[model samples]
Target: MKLSSEQIKQKLKDAGLRVTPQRHAILEAVYTLGNHPSAEQVIDFIRVRYPGIATGTVYNVLDVMVESGLVKRVKTDKDAMRYDAIMNRHHHIYCAESDRIEDYFDEELDELLQAYFRKKKLQDFKIEDIILQIKGNFNDNSE
Candidate 1:
């Protein structure tokens, strides 16, 4: 899901954000990393090439990206904030032992949850999006 420089610039423009070198590098780092990375990790990645980028700039760009719907912030059970570039409706599978996060997409699961919540109908409450972060370890069948 890594975006090219041009694609990143186009996304910024579409989101009404002015494209800058820092934003371009930050967005590219998030998408290229694939695995959800915390702000520190993003800074480390970008610092390799753009040593002049400050920590505040990275955080600011990430905040703007989240506000503009270009990226989503994933908070783990440990309260570590990570970034995800995928904007589609999907859940996540988090492995505690390996500290890995994988995307899980199931239309059936989404429909079931929506139906159940609709039936419950909490008074005066509106449902936004459902996030199910299943945490566990993956067993290797080959072993």
Candidate 2:
């Protein structure tokens, strides 16, 4: 899921953001890290390329990105905040033991859930996006 620098700048443009060295590097970092990176993880990654970048800058950029729907946030059971670069609608498979999160996409399941929820038609609640966090061990091969 790697993106070229031009593609990264295009994403920023689409998000109506001005492209700066830090913004470009941060967006690329989010995609390159590719592990639902936390703020700390993103900072570490950006720091390698941008040694003088500030922690606050990274956090502020992440907030802006999230607000613009450039990335989605994932919180582990331990309350660790993580960021996902994949913008498409998808859920997560969380492994508690390893603290790893993987994207899961199932169109049929999405349709089923949507239909079920639509049938309920709860008042005063607008369904914006459906996200599910499935928690378990990734390598559970026990008999």
Candidate 3:
């Protein structure tokens, strides 16, 4: 799911956001990191290449990305905010021990959830998307 610079730039344009070096770098960092990264982690990663990058700038770019649906914030039980680049409908496997997050995609699970919600038809609510963050640890033999 790695995206090229051109793809990232196109994404920005598609989101009605101006393409800038900072924005590109921030988006690239998020995608490149793959693992959900926090603002401090992103800042550290960016600093390795662009030492002049400021914390505020990274936070601002992240806000824009979140607003434009390019990235989503994932909060851990400890309330730490992490940014994820993937926007597709899916769930998460959160390792509480390590604070690690992994994307989980199951078409059947999605169908089942949708069917259950549709059947319930909760009062006057409508369904948009379902995000399940399953928390647990994974052994080396587990997958």
Q: Name the best candidate (by lDDT).
A: 1
Model 3 whole-model lDDT (C-alpha atoms): 0.89
Reference-based TM-score of each model = 0.91, 0.94, 0.92
Q: What is each predicted model's overall lDDT from 0 to 1? A: 0.90, 0.89, 0.89
Q: Write the per-residue lDDT of candidate 3 for residues 22-42, one digit (tens) a residue.
A: 999899999999899998888
User: Candidate 1: which stretches are off by over 4 Å?
Assistant: 140-143
Ranking by TM-score: 2, 3, 1
User: For every candidate structure, what is the RMSD over all alpha carbons to the true structure, in angstroms?
Assistant: 2.2, 2.1, 2.2
| lDDT (Cα, tens digit) per residue for candidate 1, span 25-55 | 9999999988889999999999998999999
Between candidates 1 and 2, name the one with more favorable TM-score.
2
Number of the top TM-score candidate: 2
Worst 10 residues of 2 by lDDT: 134-143
Given candidate 2, what's the lDDT at residue 11?
Answer: 98
Cα lDDT of model 2 by residue, 1-143, tens digit: 78999999999999999999998988999999998999999898888767999989988999999999898888887776889889888999988777878899999999999999989987999999989989888776343
**Residue 41 lDDT (model 2):** 91
Query: Which pairs clash (backbone N, Cα, C closer than 3 Å) in model 3?
Result: none
